[model samples]
Target: MEKIAAIIGGGVIGGGWAARFALMGWQVRVFDPDPEAERKIGEVMANAERALPMLYESPMPKRGEITFHDTIAEAVVGATYVQESVPERLEIKQKVYAELQKHVAENAVLASSTSGFKPSELQEGAARPQQILVAHPFNPVYLLPLAEVVPGQASLEVIEKASETLRDIGMYPLHIKAEIDAHVADRLLEAVWREALWLIKDGICTTEELDDAIRYGFGLRWAQMGLFETYRIAGGEAGMKHFMAQFGPALKWPWTKLMDVPEFNNDLVDLIAGQSDDQSGHMSIRELERLRDNNLVAMMRALKGQEAAAGKLIRDHDARLRGPLADEVPLVTVRRTVPVDWVDVNGHMNEGRYGQVFSDASEELMAHVGADRAYIDAGNSYFTAETNIKYLDETLVGEEFFVETRVALGEGKKLRLLHEMKRASDGAVLSSCDQFLLHVSLETRKSCPPLPDVLAAVEALADKHAG
Candidate 1:
């Protein structure tokens, strides 16, 4: 059966949730009270159109259609998952939950994208609390894969099932042992945010300076390895125990007030927002989000090559969120054995030249999309944002091999591509490269929606592999 997910609210967070599930190939139905929901959701989707494909090297899954619903009940009809992102008011949330319980399918999991409220509060009067839990996602849900699942007295089996479902969609679901306000990740972030506020209020640093310290230092470490792992590494040859023992004495320093209360006064808010304005100068929020996602795509791509946790996330994402399949896009013929130069010192195919074969295949894809030299001359081109490869067999010099490119997902401004590298002689599988690329406007250095003809071609490619 085809998996489907429904989104309610259609605000920034709702739009992100819609894009996240939709890009992963789930049929999505969105319902929102906002009269201008379409325009706002369109903006959010536009950003995702460019960012989602760049998250991996391979093609993404064929995106399901996004259907707009006039009411919440209409949206949840046959959904496997229901993500609620309505306004934060408790009574409003309660009302929405009541309505959702009536319409959402019995077997479907219901998740709330509430960051501040506990699941217990949202599920207080829920008819199916066991299936209702928190699947809180960070703001830019399409890009960030972390999904903190906080179950509210829900059955363990239900929680696990929900987590597994989320994992299938390329998310890292951290199941909290017990229900708590804000849960794990948000609590940790709150601590840091509180401290940052104190530092700013005390005139210790500007907003930009605080951001610099985090991003340039610990942020880089945290990307591939979490805080605990980094600390364990810092402990050196002695390991975590010995390292902690040696550095335990420094804990007594009066450097931080971990328990200090923070006052969210208007003056403080104005000061911070003003400082932020000065730091960013004139870029709109959309522009900043785009820039941030591009950097994240690049960073995550590098991590994928190293086979790190983040890299594994990208792989899981590719396997689940496949792009439009290029089965009908007649396979290009390559009849040569692997050249000696193609095999690096490691006795496997080098990473760089995987592009050469893929690039040759991409020519067909570009032509299929109407992006020929004329398109390039018109200031449009495709840029590789990310790629992940799995080496299954070692190919030595003179080992016959051939590669085939297939469209795994195609939509909006991005495309997910999958390539199979196999030995030509015995037909042994060699490797696979999964990539995400953006259809970019060279002049703007930003993504532009594919033209109608190009979009039509993409739809044809996607349709040929719909099964």
Candidate 2:
């Protein structure tokens, strides 16, 4: 059965939540009064469609339906999850929650996308307050993996379920044991933001320089290793304790205005905004979003290989989502829409990536017949001896396609495979590959026959294909 996610606002965060849920195969109902909600949400989805899939090799679930509802009741009617992304005002949020109880099921998890508002504050004066928890997601929710799950007067069950649900959909849910003012990541962000404001207010550094300090400095390490862990490595073999001990005195240093506020006067505001403009004002907002998404995709892909931090979430979930399969028909081994990150300077799927696609399909075929990870671990695996790829048509970003693979031959020590990469919209062959592999014993590092069971499975698939 298809799942339904009710989104109660259509602004950036709400729209982001919608995109995240919808892309994860949950039919999403969005309720908002803004006339421009669809256009704005569409823009967010466009960016998401290009970026999210690049993080995984396996096929994503089929995209679910998105409907803009006229009312909150209409939206939450059969929703399994109701996410409120309205403005941060308490009264406004409570009113929506009050109306929500009448339509949404008691079992449905109610989540708020409020960045700063604690779950307690959000649930205050609201009906069925225990159901409302803060599932605060970062901006560009589809691309970013972190979703802070903060419970109010809710059950641990709710928190666990919410966390698991978010994890299943490629998010890293950080559970807050105590309901603080701001959730974990945001609290750290606030400290940094406060100091940055003071710096700009005092003309200590321009907005660009401050940004460079982050992006060009510890930001890269912090992306995967995080603060204390990076510092632990800095401490050498002494570890986190030694690092903390060495730097503990700096906590009281008067270096940062972390607790102080810069008055939001017109002069400071103008200086910050003007400097920000001079730094990145040339690019439009959409262009900037694309740029950000591209950088994030590249960085995340690098991390995925290392199974580090958020990339590890993608890696783990992808493993659970896939397993060995045996198929006869040119099996649809790869089904995915092209990601913008796949595009090259010529504005199409880069030629090298086509080779990657073919390689992935061949790997999938290898797995299908039990010649997978365990087989490789057992010191016997297929080594590609030859491959021929022919690109028939130009493939572009966001274009849905599938690779239908067939085992042409499955002899004792060798196998031959053919993969037809076709566009999903129309059965047009985008590319084709013929791959020949020689099974080898890892111990001997020479040509050898696959194990009996793997050999049987391969021959079975080849026989089925031939039939």
Candidate 2 local lDDT, 380-467, one digit each (tens): 8888899999989999977889898888999899899898899988889999999999999999999988889889988988888894
lDDT of predicted model 2: 0.86
Q: Which regions in candidate 1 have their CA more than 4 angstroms from the true location?
A: 319-329, 332-467
> Once model 2 is optimally superposed onto the true structure by TM-score, how far is the C-alpha of residue 319 displaced, in angstroms?
2.7
Pairs that clash in candidate 2: none
lDDT (Cα, tens digit) per residue for candidate 1, span 1-467: 89888998999899998887887778999999788988888888877866766555445567888889899888988888888899888899889989988877777888888887888898787887787888888878887888889888677776887888788778889887787888888899988998899999999999999999999999999988998899999999988998789888888987676788668899999999999999996898888987787677667767776878777788666645434434454443233334334557788667776666566557557765787778888888878888887877776654556666666778888887777777867878777778888888889999877777887777677666554
TM-score of each: 0.71, 0.95
User: After superposition on all CA atoms, what RMSD does each candidate show versus the true structure?
Assistant: 15.7, 1.9
Kindly report which residue stretches of model 2 are placed more than 4 angstroms away from their true locations once superposed.
323-328, 339-344
TM-score of 2: 0.95
lDDT (C-alpha) at residue 348 in model 1: 66
Worst 10 residues of 1 by lDDT: 332-341
lDDT of 2 at 383: 86
